[model samples]
Target: MVDFIVGKYNYWIYIVLMMIGFYAMIGKKNLIKKIIGMNIFQTAIILFYVSIGCKKGATLPILGHAHGHAGQAIQTSAYINPLPHVLMLTAIVVMVATLGVALAIGIMIYLKYNTLEEDEILKAVK
Candidate 1:
């Protein structure tokens, strides 16, 4: 049990981050807080994916020159998988775009409603 917990500490950290974000989104009343929570959640997911793509003592996926020229057997397990990292790069771009749009929308809401609180906005709307 100790080994399992110690070895997977990153996962535990990610889970805690996710829960914090989830609680902020669900329990907060302010729109800005909710948007921040969503960003935190996305960041946690990206971190989780990036962490899972790593391996113990693994190098990059790039093939060394000697292996290709000398006809040496390429050991697949010696390299870390690059797909998750690549996907997370794309996700980071998307996350930034989403954050910008969300902030813009929040600004618009604040301008129109004169407040950033969801309950206050609802009351004004009603």
Candidate 2:
């Protein structure tokens, strides 16, 4: 149990970060705070994916001279699996675009309502 927990500390840390972000998104009344929380949540997920994609002895999946041997059989296991990293890169781009759009909308809301709080906006709306 101890070994398992100790070995997977990165997962535990990210989980805590994810939960904190989740709470901030759900519990905060300010639109800016919620946006920040969402960004944090997305960042945590990206970090988690990146962390899991790494291997201790793995090199990049480049096509040249793996393991100091040119013109030799390339071992697949020697290279890192880059799918998760690639997917996370795309996710990061999407996350940034989403954040920009969300913030723009939030700014529009504040402009119209003169406030950024969810409760205040709702009260103003109705």
Candidate 3:
């Protein structure tokens, strides 16, 4: 169990970060704080995905090494998987777009009520 945890420290870190973000998103009363928490959660998820593409002693998945001579075969295990990293890049763009929309909504809410608090907004709405 200790070996598993030690070997997968990135997962542990990501989990901790995700939990913190989850807590902030649910526990905070302010709309802006919730948005910040969402950003944190997005970041943790991206890092976790990128980490999944990494290997301990692997190189990037560059096609055909320029310096390698003929008859020398490249081992697949020596190269890190690039798919997760590519997917995470797309995820980051989506996260940014959503965050922008959320912030815009938050701004509108604040402009209307002069407060970013969820409870205050609810009371004002009522």
Better of 1 and 2 by TM-score: 2
Clashing pairs in 3: none
Stretch of 10 with least lDDT, candidate 1: 64-73
Would you list the C-alpha lDDT of every candidate in the order shown?
Answer: 0.91, 0.91, 0.90
Where model 2 places Cα greater than 4 Å from the true spot, the runs are: 63-70
Compared with the true structure, what per-residue lDDT tens digits does model 2 show for residues 1-126? 999999988899899989889998999999999999999999899989988888879888676644578758778788888899899989999999999999999999999999999999999999
- The lDDT of model 2 is 0.91
Clashing pairs in 1: none
Give lDDT tens digits, candidate 1, residues 1-126: 999999999999999999999999899999989989988999999989989899888998777676555776677788898999999999999989998998999999899999999999999989
How far is each candidate from the true structure, as Cα RMSD in Å?
Answer: 2.2, 2.1, 2.1
How many residue pairs of model 1 clash at the backbone? 0
Candidate 3 structure quality by residue, lDDT tens digits, 1-126: 999999999999999999888888999998988998999998999989988899879988776655764567777788899899889989999999999999999999989999999998999999
